[model samples]
Target: MTAVIAEEDINRIRWHCRRGMLELDMVLARFLEEHADRLTAPQWQEFERLVSLEDHALWQRITATSVTDSTVERLLRGCIIC
Candidate 1:
């Protein structure tokens, strides 16, 4: 991502990905752990933005209750198949 991800930042991102929702946590944490280093700068930034969302809002996007912004959806599309 930003000049290629550092191990330290990857760990930090992993911690931040521990979300209030278990489903979100699993999806995000695993995704970051597996691919944070491989992400583009935009993807990394978008992921940070995605994780910043509160639990209910995040869940709505994950569960399709709300057809929300595309940033989160695009990032998630790789990990989640609809």
Candidate 2:
């Protein structure tokens, strides 16, 4: 059965996507595409809302991060101070 997605959920997803988290963006994309057919009316609405955000705002959010770390650094250092 299709699941209903609320507008708030879409906003949250959009926020995450704008944050420039590759992992999160990919996850959300996969989820929406996979369940496209099964989405309820509300779910579809939420998805549409996500698509309506300004490109600049989305880009800024997606790229903004508290700390900058390279992929290799994360893999090897593992975010450990010690």
Candidate 3:
């Protein structure tokens, strides 16, 4: 059976994805640039697989969350793979 992700875990992942570290930010930036048109099916699938989430759900959470006060180190704490 697939493990059910808790709300807290989702939040933590979102937080990390947004504010983890400079390296992560760079990676995400490159991803966004390369996928600007969202036309690459394989890249889209890979991104979803990497995050262990569906695209729509992940985008919704990312768009809804605010990262005004989070720091790289703080977010990194939450990114640890249990």
RMSD of each: 3.2, 11.7, 14.9
Error of 3 at 50 (Å): 1.4
TM-score of each: 0.70, 0.33, 0.33
* C-alpha lDDT of residue 38 in model 2: 67
Predicted structure 3: clash tally: 0
Runs of candidate 2 with Cα error greater than 4 angstroms are 1-29, 56-82
Instruction: Please tell me which model should have the higher lDDT, number 1 or number 3.
Output: 1
Regions of candidate 3 where Cα sits further than 4 Å from its true position: 1-16, 53-82
Error of 1 at 53 (Å): 0.7
Candidate 3 — worst ten consecutive residues by lDDT sum?
A: 68-77
Cα lDDT of model 1 by residue, 33-74, tens digit: 566656777777777776788988776666674465665465
Report model 2's TM-score to 2 decimal places.
Answer: 0.33
Q: What value does the lDDT take at residue 69 in candidate 2?
A: 42
* lDDT per residue as tens, model 2, 2-82: 666676875565554443545445544655445545666755565455445555544343345535343321221232223
Candidate achieving the largest TM-score: 1
Clashing residue pairs in candidate 2, if any?
A: 18-61, 18-62, 19-61, 19-62, 20-62
The lDDT for every candidate, in the order shown, is: 0.69, 0.47, 0.42
lDDT of 3 by residue, 1-82 (tens): 2234455754554454563345445544544444324324444344445445444554443344455342322233333332
